[model samples]
Target: MAPRLLLVEDDLHSRTAITLFLGDAGYAVDPCPDFASALRHLQNAQNDVPDYAAVLTDYNLGHRDLTGLSVCQAMRRTSNRKAPIIASSSEMKYWEEVADVFKLNLVPKLRHQWDGPAILAKLEEIGIKP
Candidate 1:
């Protein structure tokens, strides 16, 4: 079976592109537009069951309501946290904020230098196993 992945991104174009790419690369991508719904889904996953191999959360979810850092912290605090959380941030400063929230790694979305391959490989390195 294809590996399941949670993709939390607010931007339309980037979310679509990543969902298509990861799906084509043999992953089941669950795309979340913001953190509020993502948090709800994560809570449900912990309370019931989860079906994700990893979580790819965008740091800036447009507005201030649904920050990725909040989701990371919530996941860590839960009893049955089910996947490696990958935090993506455009600003390096946000890295520490989310890092303090969760024990996951961060990648800098530096213009055209966002290394998707490296991020995916690191996910594997960190025992995502998907």
Candidate 2:
């Protein structure tokens, strides 16, 4: 069976692109546009033995005070707490502290760089084949 993944990204274009890419690569992605939805998914997973193999989230999710950092924290509190959490952001340097504190694998989305490959590489490194 294809591994399941949670994807939390607020940008419509980016979210659609990432979801399509990962889906084509054979992952079953549970995509969320914001922290609230992602948190709901994570909480539900906790009650049911988390069916996800990993999580990918964008650092900035709109104007909300809660960011992907909060999502990482929530995921860590779930049953699949050890599941890999990869965070991507253009301003990744500024989020290093949060990533370190939450033990998230950081994938810098540098301007002009394709994020697909970088995200896929991180997934592979974390043992998620797809």
Question: Which is the leading candidate under lDDT?
Answer: 2
TM-score of 1: 0.81
Please write out the lDDT profile of model 2 over residues 1-130, one tens digit for every residue: 8888999988888888888988998888999999989988888888874468998888888956888888877777777678888888888865697766777888887672328888888888888994
Question: What is the RMSD of candidate 2?
Answer: 1.9
- lDDT tens digits, residues 8-121, model 1? 888887888778867776677878888877877777766876556788888788878657876777666664375677778777677675575467777766562335676667
**Cα lDDT of all candidates, in order?**
0.72, 0.82
Number of backbone collisions per candidate: 0, 0
**TM values, all candidates:** 0.81, 0.90
Clashing pairs in 1: none
